[model samples]
Target: MPLIPKSHPRAKSLLIREKLVKGFDNGLVAKEGLLAQGRGEAFDYLLGEKTTKSAKKAIRAAAAQILLAERPVISINGNIAALCPKEIVKLSKQTKAKLEVNLFYANKNRKQAIIKILKKSGAKVVLGSNISTSTKLPRIDSARRVVDKNGIFVADVVVVPLEDGDRTIALRKAGKTVITFDLNPLSRTSQTANITIVDNVTRAIDLLIYDSKKLSKKNHSSLRKIVDDFDNKKNLSENILEIRKNLTRGAKIA
Candidate 1:
């Protein structure tokens, strides 16, 4: 299908629907793809396609972390581009993070799609991946097989938008800090990320950017410790229990 006209009034929705098609083809996505889309749309609406309180915190923390890094790379995937290409570009400017395409379905066409959107949004970084992309820094994991790359590889921080567990593991092994957005706190991506914002991407990204605008060059060492201290499994269980408890109380009230 032709690329959706980004300038058009319905461009955002059109892109969202198209990415859903690509997401299903990628196959690693959750089984409830349609349901997820509906939920994300609702979240985008609630957020007014802008920032939220929690998301604002997340963005500030993320930008501060990246700014502290000697090398920061923002990993852009199809879903991220489709959802918030403009914001992604803004983030690249804010954090000085290189925009790189790292998706489950890495290919020529996919790279082109990523580049098209980023460039359209005025992001300066060229197309690149774990396998082949021009970088003075050495390649760590080519062919997308390895769990991690080893070296002072030019990315101390990696913002993995729309990520999963496998690559998140790789980033950890590489000693690179990861910031992610995940609604299902139980997912591996959320569990492994150094900073996990448990919310929809549109809301999360906007908040992060908003905070990015306000945050200075100061580091967030204390916040990093908090994030590290939180256990993924425990956090997920707590979230689930809270939801269940609230639902049970609501049932009693009814």
Candidate 2:
């Protein structure tokens, strides 16, 4: 990776790209993951490259849901492992949520690479490595359907950052509450998820961890109220409006 000057206008974005490129070289990210990151980056630009109020609300609700859940699992992919492995591990510890590596482009070496990163980041037990213990998710044919029986398969709530659409729908059908971080509010993964934080995962993940810690001290009923008060569709609509506002503002600036 090249040296990215902190004073550079797109410093954060540039650093994220470099990280993904390095992850690809390290076998922690697939070739397709680079392309996916590009798409999400475009949306992040539209979002003004910051976490919005709607995103914060969704993050709080997601945190509450995780705390209230009997079994909550955070599904990690190659990009997540490369980008924020330490934050992921912290959130897992804070929320007591299980960490499971699930990928669309699944391979043994890639899986091992991700697990190695997570463990190095202080994760004690990362699931989804052994195929013998894996179970198939209903209504999805993608490689992401192969889930560890003790993790996602049994989880009451799932935190899937940078997730695909079909699996979000499938998880819902399987009777699990799905929470996701997506830059594009209009994407299927954003729309289908029970709680969608339409923000950059790198930024929103830390907030989720913070909220998880704060909400953990509250009673179950208080946490339940936060979850009950959230409306995913409404929040998504607000995020869309935010994009429209940003476009209009940019046009005016031009």
Candidate 3:
């Protein structure tokens, strides 16, 4: 029957409907977890809200796999460019993955801006599409990216650092291995990925570079293992559980 004090600042984002109250009365244990929202407002969403030992292990495994791989690619988008430019470049250097700019917001100007940032960091680079792009869904088709069926698509592993849904699916269907950095585990992009690293882009990329640089030779089995181990259905199922279980959070704390 008690409630958090009105003075609590985090009360703003709360949307405790009658259903939650009813559940509480029904003896449902208070849910547990970090909220699913963009970073900063919700405890840095990629920090896992309440980062888990499992998520950490997954990230490390992913990094290790990439490090021990012969062919890998790091796909960059505007969000990644804006947030972790240096780290992106560093990982590319370490993994020797081709650095390619792929975005939902496609345009020649945007591509050039991303390229300019990467080139300044002294990283090897490639453009995802042959056509100069300034469009989104129109340019990068839903199931098919006008993306060179040759350049990035040919790589054994593709790291889509920050991505949208359609391209992730498209890349996999095109037969390229896909690794993605996504905070929302339930998202289509995350579930579809060969490796889903649920960590902050800045921190994750740094860890990835550190892991990749430690490798002396490629481990084809390791790469294949991640690809084989990932299960889209299970990932979504677990994430949904986490979301519902944690929905009854305490005083809003970012």
In order of listing, the candidates' clash counts read: 1, 0, 5
lDDT against the true structure, per candidate, is: 0.63, 0.95, 0.58
Tens-digit lDDT track of model 2 for 1-254: 89999999999999999999989999999999999999999999998999999999999999999999999999999999989999999999988899999999999999999999999999999999987899999899999999999999999999999999999999999999999999999999998999999998999989998999988899999998999999999999999999999999999999
> In model 3, which regions exceed 4 Å deviation?
1-50, 68-70, 129-144, 215-254
Per-residue error for 125 in candidate 1, Å, reads: 1.8
Model 3 lDDT, full chain set: 0.58
How close is every model to the real structure, measured as TM-score?
Answer: 0.68, 0.99, 0.67
Candidate 1 lDDT, 1-254, residue by residue in tens: 56777688767666667766765464322345456577556534433444434444555566567666667777776667666789889988886777776545556666676677789899876446344434332233543332123212457888887676777777787677888877655667778888766666765777677666666443477545534454545544554554455567767989
Ranking by TM-score: 2, 1, 3
Model 2, which residues run further than 4 Å from truth? none
lDDT over C-alpha atoms for residue 97 of model 1: 75
Please give the distance, in angstroms, between residue 216's alpha carbon in candidate 1 and its true position after superposition. Answer: 2.1
What C-alpha lDDT, on a 0 to 100 scale, does residue 188 get in candidate 2? 94
Error of 2 at 190 (Å): 0.7
Cα RMSD of all models vs. native, in order, equals 6.6, 0.7, 11.7
* lDDT score for residue 65 of model 3: 61
